[model samples]
Target: MGEKQQRDRDLTRWGVSRRYSSLDMFYLFPIGEGLHTIEHKGRLFDLLIQNRGSDTTLVVFHGSLPPTQLTLPCLQGEGVSRLADVNLIALADPSLVMGDIDCAWFLGDRRIGPLRPILSPVIRYVLDSLNSKRTILFGGSGGGYAAVNFAQDFPGSIALAMNPRLNFNGTPSSKLPRYLEVCHGAMSRTPMLRVKRDFMTPNLLDDVNKQQDFDLLVVQNKNDKRYLHRQVNPFLSGVENPTRTWVSLFNGGDGHVPLPREEVAKLLKDLSNMESQTSDEYNSLGFESLGDYKQSVLSQDFS
Candidate 1:
């Protein structure tokens, strides 16, 4: 089968209907929005400019699907309405692999550097043009992995990685053959594999430890069988400055499920309202485990 046909079949299998072109899908954003597609290094990215501009911009890296699939719809239906004032840019992996455009967890693919040359200039231009003081990176799952990696590149940026798989090399505890297959494919396509060990989370923590300016928020379910051992535990333990990096563990869900749209919106809104923090102060928030968190929720005691 042809590439386009295969993509169509995949989308159909995923219960997604291609109602709009990749670029045209941005119209689903708020009315009177300036949305356009830009080509960088032969890859297409959607840029959405809010009518009433602000110095804050949210860069969204979608999970393992095409941009036109699940991510765009969620942003349009759930995120855009809640974050109408914030500038938004959505990026997708056209290759549909977990390399995430060279933003993988493992230190493989020497050709795939820390930052994509094509995207760096555009990102710099956007930040400069808006005089953006606060840049927030948001993503879930595979996209969350990308967010964490990219957050290091942009100084003083806040990153929210929901249920991120910290190590691509380790086998997922869950039974997800397709996800694993795609990830392996991405790794195989890379020209070189510099690091072979399964220490991606530790390496990431080490990298984050050097930078004392940014905040990394990792959200995961304590009951997540897929990455509790492989990703979350290692990340929480390895991070040098516990004060700067925080983990918010919830109850009653697998690693793959995303937080509710309302809750996510509220968090973004709160962050938007707050002044950017210069120091990385440790906030002892969230629960130690799902049991503790569940008890608090049941007791209606959030304090």
Candidate 2:
């Protein structure tokens, strides 16, 4: 397809036209609490916003979908609006729209460039204009990967991830290879090399261990043996700072399923209320038992 044809196709697929990149461009249009198109480095970033004029903003990211599912998740529903003290902004992973992939962790395809780098500045621009004092990024499963991935860019941000895929190295899903083929310029097809590339900084447990600025709260269902063995165990084993990185285990749900929305809202509300406290006092945020769980992971062979 030609450039114009491709742009038109994307426009139809994404459903936005008025692109804004800078503060000047953003103010050119009357951006309110709804879906808006953000143009960053010639690529359109879809953002759904609920402008409550609050100091705190909850940025929600959606997880993977079935191949037949076309519409963006979290966009059509009343997402994260239960917390009235915060403004809302939700992002759709643009990579899902481009061909047979279901989840790319918002890593973006080669043509679209790296999404986190592009989106970091764009989101910061939007948050600056909104005068947001605090940010909380929320997601589950694949979306949880993206929530933690992007939260690193914004210091003092909190990432609430449930049953998150910490690294793409060992994931059996073909989407990672498909993403590498499509997004990373068709690099080496070898699995080992692919694993190396996938787990680079900002996208792996090793990188997350080095992160001290942002608080990470990972909620895992104890019944989900798959995630416990594949993701949660390995992640907890590598955690450097127990205070900053919290692992909360619940005794419900099966493999890869999300926690009840009511529980999620409670955690978010707790984090939002404690945003004003210094980093030292963050351990008192009602997750004091996380270290015990981490110790249990270490004692057993959950890996």
Candidate 3:
């Protein structure tokens, strides 16, 4: 009823449903608050985690905005419940992360404020607990943006950003961007990648390369009416996306992060299978096929 109150129904609109695998979803914070000043703009934040396995953890960050009229439930992908062992975390205070996150970005630049480098330790702590090299990150819109930001600062992580906004500051104002500018104020201007000389070079993306390029997965539907699907082009202008990307653009659910249950199941299964495949079998997926052998070898590391 108020700004801080949260009422949970089915996080199904994001392509997930309660009917699936009954994987335990844990609310790490009733009123999720990430500490600020942990590193500059670093503040307390909320975490929505679905703890699953020791092998890999999937941290799901919501878009950066207050709320959305779209009302797409939290990413209700069947894979979440089915792969119960995979850890999932929605790292953000939805109301604070993105401007009043509707759909554009989940980890609101306005609220989260100029990408805190201080969050590095917390990320490392999570990795240590997971006992893995890089944890799988998930986000649609703003949350997707946050996933990229975090991965840039902390390497050894994979991100599945569904139609993510890869750049910040100097980008044209979109529906969500305009709203965040109006609400969160001077904070959103906090550059994720502060480059005094070339502000337009996607410094965040550049730094991401300096650390790890990420096993980046970009999923988007061509019919998306929110922003232009052309937004996806920025992801690859200077970066190397995953050698083997399993992109599904069919329009069934939300253009951002929605997919049918069966398809979701298949996608997850394939990803897991890819991770488990022997070196040769996994390479067949791609990379060497096009002389991108380096990436193929990287994928093999998962196995």
Candidate 4:
């Protein structure tokens, strides 16, 4: 009969095992290290959180998945242990009305109006609950777009993206057009330019240039020619502040895919350690940048 009672009834109807007294209570509940669905503002977010009892939280956003499948990468095999002691949370993007869509860059679905506004608050709530002092956003491809986009909301956070697609509007062959038509209710007759600009920013560089406090680490595979020329190169060149961004170009892996997981792990660990120390301290300790760090790690990996 009451609002809380109605909400409880809905959760029970949806087959949720537990009942929460309130949304705040749900967000505050001690989360064990595993897959969880946090309901916020009438939307459900699937998050796989690996808690390591550390002050740092690494939120990994998944790239485009296969048709009709919703699998989170880095969840299998080595799992979150590759990041070591940092708390890792892997998030799955909500599908559009179509079931085959992989990711929408956390742009929200028909059910939930705009996603980032809702999703950002939900993540902030989670970070607060975890008492996270430092935050890192990681992802590849479309997920990379999400990592950089969301980093704008959390200033001073780290955004580690691998071969990220920065311009959705420019890449007409990408899933953006279809995503707009299905999720945002754009008609076939509607101009794509209007749809893209109306629903979300056409380019991520626009947002990246505006944020001053965050650090961006972009790892790109040189073989991904299309992305290298269109997305990565353009994005990097457009960056107003080179000091806040790091780029690592390598020849590992095939087109568009990220470098080997082991190499990525080494980079993450090295960056995590170095970031914990101030720049002056890091320079004093003889480290210039993550590019140098990547080279060092690569030399060791090959040898």
Q: Quick one: ranking by lDDT, best first?
A: 2, 4, 1, 3
Tens-digit lDDT string for candidate 1 (104-198): 33222223323344454555565666667778788877677767877766878888787886655454732223322343332343311322322
Candidate 4 per-residue lDDT over residues 7-43, each given as its tens digit = 1112222233343444576666776556666565455
Q: After superposition, how far is residue 228 of candidate 2 from its true place, in Å?
A: 1.5
Tens digits of per-residue lDDT for model 3, 1-303: 124333343333333211211111211212122221121233333334354554665666666444453332344323563544455444544333232334434332444443344344545555565565436666666666667666654454566666667665424344543444433442334532232222122434666555564555555554563432235444344454434333334464544445444654444445444554233443454313212432443234224
Better of 2 and 3 by TM-score: 2
Worst 10 residues of 4 by lDDT: 1-10
TM-score of 4: 0.77
Ranked candidates, highest TM-score first: 2, 4, 1, 3
TM per candidate? 0.65, 0.81, 0.57, 0.77
Pairs that collide in candidate 2 are 110-183
Query: Model 2, stretches more than 4 Å misplaced?
Result: 1-18, 21-24, 27-31, 40-42, 72-77, 83-85, 171-174, 184-203, 275-286, 301-303
TM-score of 1: 0.65
Please give the lDDT score at residue 249 for candidate 1.
65
Error of 3 at 283 (Å): 7.8
What is the C-alpha lDDT profile of model 2 across 87-114, one tens digit per residue? 7777877665555556778776667656
List candidate 4 segments past 4 Å from native.
1-25, 40-42, 67-83, 96-98, 189-195, 275-303
